[model samples]
Each structure stands twice: as structure tokens, then as C-alpha cells.
Target: MPRVSFAPPSLCLTFLPLLERLLPSLPPTVRDVDVPPLFREQFILSGYRPVDLSWRCYVLSLFQIHNETLSVWSHLLAAVYVLVRFLMFAVQQGGGILGVGLQGPEGQGFSVDVSSLPLVLYVFSAVTYLSCSAAVHLLHSEQTHHSLFFLEHVGVAVYQYGCALALCLYSSDTGWTQSMLGQIFLPVVAVVVWLSCIICCYADLHFHRPYLWHRRICQVVPMGVAYLLVISPVTHRLASHNWTNTSTLPLHFLQVALFLLSAVFFSCPVPECFSPGRYDIIGHSRQLFHILLSICTLVQQEALFEDFLWRRQALVREFGEERLLLACASFLGLTLCCVMTALVMKRRTHVQLLQEGR
Candidate 1:
């Protein structure tokens, strides 16, 4: 006779095969807590920090898990939408020019290039904000927290200035460009002031860990001033009992309100802040901010579309091509300046992070 002993399968060995299968599906090197101090204030509980990830992994993150997934996807998709809009406007402008040229007295060449400046800037600004935001959220860990944050703000300034210019171009007659004293100058001043505000914040650069709301208000206030200056014509017309462009007025005001609410969400950062770990992967305020911002931009894009149809000829007749081109060049220069400052800040901060052993 022999004594026989039977043992159950080892739990570790039994699960090993399944674990191996799931391992490839999971993101490698996902950090759960213990995020470095530099990234703390920027992310505010981004669940798993992916450290030292390659650019390939950053792109793969389009499908991977992380706190920034929503923020990244929303803006990237917006970038696609904007590019499509840019093309759509170009095609329509071509059609309009062709139709007008054939019907007009001369039936010769047209100045579609100058007429399309607003839309071009509209596209440029949209792409800037969307791509920069997507880049920031997707690669914040790569650039260190503060550097990306600074870049994101600068991107918004450029985008805001673009939106302001677009609305002014389509909102008013081209004559506005000639009257630098009363009208066009306001927006340029506002852009300068907005840049100054951004620079001041980065001067000593507190980054405002606890007082996130203060930073939010500080950044948006100057932007709001720029917006207000650009839209003053609308305000003036409506106040003076002129109902010419009333159709877009209500929608524009609605957009202004939505943006104001976006600021509120940015400042408060609710739900996520309420339960730190609970909303780590989703439902964060930044996600909401990005969504609201996209919607606001979309609404404004539509408004510009209608305004363009109405104001196209007025724009062509009122402002010369040289003036429009110079203005576009100036806008591009200002946008470049903001971007340059952000680049410099990023490099300096990278050095700081290295010294701090992050």
C-alpha cells in the first residue's frame, strides 16, 4: 500500500499565465502616487505619472490609461476639427470669389488671398491652442510641470488674440483698420497688456500651489480685457440702438458667458478637489475647462462664418491688401514672441528641475 497526497494548484502559478497576458495590455511604468514635487501642483492628482516616457509612448498614450487622457483627446480632436474648418472656409471663399469675379464688371483676377486672412489666422490660432494644449497635457511629465504650464498659458494668449482679431475683422467694416486711433489700436494695446501680464507672472513665477484660483483669475482677467476691447464695436452698436448685426450678438454674449463659466471652473477646480483620489482618472476641472473652451471656440467660429459672408465685400473695399498683410504679419510676430518666451521659460525650468534632482 502507498500513501498518496494531492495538493491544489499553486495560486501564484495558476495566475501567472493570465497575469502575463494582462501585462502587455497594461501601461508599463505607471506611477501610482509618490509623484515628484515639481509636478504636484500642475497635475493635482493625475493618477499615475508616467516618468521618462519616450515620444513613442507619449503618442501611444492616445490609447493608454492616465489622468490626462480626456484632456489630451479633447484638444487633439479639436485640432482636427479646426483644420477641417480651415479647409472648408478656404473652399467656400474660392467659390465666392469665382462667382463674384465672373459676375462683376471686369471678370478678372480676385483678391481672395487678402480676404482670407481672418480665416487663416482663425485657423492658425485654433491650431496653436489645440496642439499646444494636447502637447502640454500629453507631455507634461516629459517637460516638467511648470514649463508645460507656462507654455499652455502662452498658447491661450495667442489663441485669444487670434479670436479677437477674427471677430474684429468679420465684425466691423475694413475701415476699422485705417482708424488706428479709435479702434484697431485698442486690440493691439490689449494684446500688449495681456503679454505683460503673462510675463509678470513668470517674472518671479510663484506658480500658486494653493491659490490656484488666484492664478486663474489673474490670467483670464487680461484676456478678458483683450476680448472686451475687440468686441467694443458690438457693444457700441447695440448700445446705440443699431440692430444691424443683432443676429450674432446674442450668440456672442452667450459665448462670453460660457467663457466666464469656464474661468469659474478653472478657478474652483471642483469635484476632483472635493475627493482627491476618487476623481483621479476622470471628472477633473481641467477636463471641464478644456471642453468648455473648445465649445466656446466652436461657437465663435460659427459666428465668424456668418459675419464673413455679410462683411466680405466691405472688408475688401475698405482695407487695402498691404494693410491687411502687414496686420497679419504683426499678429504673427506677437504670437511668436509669446511662444518664444515660453520656450525660454521651459529651458530655464528644465535646468532647475535637473539641479533639484527631479
Candidate 2:
């Protein structure tokens, strides 16, 4: 056998350039003026990845420095972290694949409960929305931007339904639950959430750059309605309950505050608007929105988990098995409706793009 020659570290470093040359390179990022108006974020003056690149290029672009890089990684990491934390919590609680168990009153042994179902659904929705948001950032292309936008809206609708479901079941006080509005809250929320998704998609399709305010109003109004409906229970609980008695109340307040602050960033470009080109690579309003929303989700999850554990028995007794099942089923149906709505909107978007091309 011929003597084998081992390259020293310095000599190995010399081949790094050649190795890099053999691999595919990321597409060059473009300035706002270089891309179509549809892809240009307001006040984000640079670091846009070129449009019409291959899917592989878009995926590879995740590692490259660009405006959407943080948006993609923030939610992607959040989804993974949320999922892992949930699974760890489930395992620690001695839960099965479907639900978690807690020790019963009077020294009764731990038992698997359907009361955990809403919480489970909430976690599922959180993961889904985070993943969808990440995909909207990562896989965005000129051809499919409308579809991704619709998908993100659907994800938001699903998440809103999840929060409403959990709050309705676990967080609402008995007085609130028995109230007229609470009786019909979930049903109304389902309608409003679906409408919100539709309105957002329609706004995206109909309004271009010049009609920015019109589009924002269309998108924000339905969402505001849905949010108010969903948050009503939390508001009631906060108002009625004794402040010093509950540990989770602070988390509820924190989540609400964080979400409201995030909405500001979502609606307006801040530091970027003031110093356009400087924030292109980082610290933009959208990135801040993503970060704040992720934290809000975590805070909300923690508060809900506490409520679920403390009130699980009361909730089960009050709502009964049939009502709980119905509530979960309604949410599932809402999710299906939102998805169908997105698909329809996506098809319309594709047709419009084709017509525009023609």
C-alpha cells in the first residue's frame, strides 16, 4: 500500500476556499428598490433576498444575512422550544400521549383527565402558528407570497380559537360562564375568527402599496373584534378576582401587555422608520413583533397551565364531559373552516398572478 499523506491544519485550510466553491451559494440580497413593491417592507431599505429564486435557495437563505432571517429563526426556535417544554412538562406530570394526570383530592391517585384537552389543544395551536409564521418568513417567494400570507392568517385564527377555548374552559369565573355573553362566546368567536382570516386575505389581494391604510384597516378590524371576543373572559376574571389571591394573575397581565405592545410594532415600523437603512439587517419592527409575541405566548401558556391545574376539577364539574367535548370539537371545526378559506384564497391569488402575468 502507498504511504498515505495527512495534510496539516494549515494545508487543510487552503482547500476550504475550493470546498466553498464546490457548494451552491446563497442568492445575493437586494435593496428595497431592487425588488417588487409587494416584497418591500416599509422602511426596510435593504437586505431583501432576491425574488424568484429556487426553493432550495430560499431554504438556504435562512443562514444568510437578510431582513427576514431573524423573523424566520425567532419563530422557528420558539416553536421548537415551546414543543420541547410542553413535552417535558407532560412527561414530568406522568401524562400519556393524549393528556396529563394530576393527583385527585382526598389522597386519590393521579388520573388522566379530559380537562387537559383544551390545554393540549392550546399548545398544539401555539406550535402550529409559530411554525406557520416561520414558514411564511422562510419560504416566501414572489409566486407564493399570497398563499403564505393566507396560511399565516389561518394560523392566527386557529391560535385565537385555541386561546378562547382554554380561557372559556379554565379561566372564566362561574359568574362569567353563566352570563349571556359567555354562553355564546365560543360560537361568536368562531365566526369572527374565520371572518378575520377572510378579511385579511382579501385585503392582501385587493389593496396594493397605495391603499396601505385601507388594507391595514381591513386586516386589523376583524382581528380586533376576534381579540376582544377572545379576551373578554380574561378581562372579566382580572376585574372580578381578588388581586392578591392569584399568582397567575400577574402573568395574565403581562401577556396582555406584551401582546398589545406587539400590536404596535406590527402596525408601525418604528426605529426602522426613523433610520431606514440602519435596521435592515436587524432590530426592525417586524422582528420586535415576533420576539414580543413569542414571549407573550410563553407567558400566556404558563398562566393557562396554572389555571388548568388549579381549576381542572371545578371546570370538569361545571362544564361536564359533553360540553368540554363539544367545545373542543367546535374549535376543530373552526380550524377546518379557516384552512379551507385559506385554500380558496390561495387559488384566487394564483389566478390573479396568472392574469397579471398575461
Every model's TM-score: 0.76, 0.90
Worst 10 residues of 2 by lDDT: 95-104
Q: List the candidate 1 regions with Cα displacement exceeding 4 Å.
A: 1-32, 41-46, 93-112, 142-146, 173-187, 190-197, 200-218, 234-246, 350-358
Q: Candidate 2, clashing residue pairs?
A: none
* C-alpha lDDT of candidate 1 relative to the true structure: 0.67
Could you give candidate 1's per-residue lDDT for residues 146-198 as a string of tens digits?
76677677777777667666766676543444456345563465466457536
Local error of candidate 2 at residue 349 (angstroms): 1.6
Cα deviation in Å at residue 308, candidate 1? 0.9
TM-score of 1: 0.76
**Evaluated with lDDT, which candidate comes out highest?**
2
* Ten-residue stretch with the least lDDT total in model 1: 95-104
How would you encode candidate 2's per-residue C-alpha lDDT over 1-358 as one tens digit per residue? 8998786788779988987665558868889889988888888889988888888788888889999989899888889888888888777666652464546567467654678889889999999999999999999998778889888998999999999999988888889989999999999999999999999989988888745688989987898789888989989989888868998888998998998999899888898989879999899999999999999998898898788878877777888988888888898999999999989988887788789983
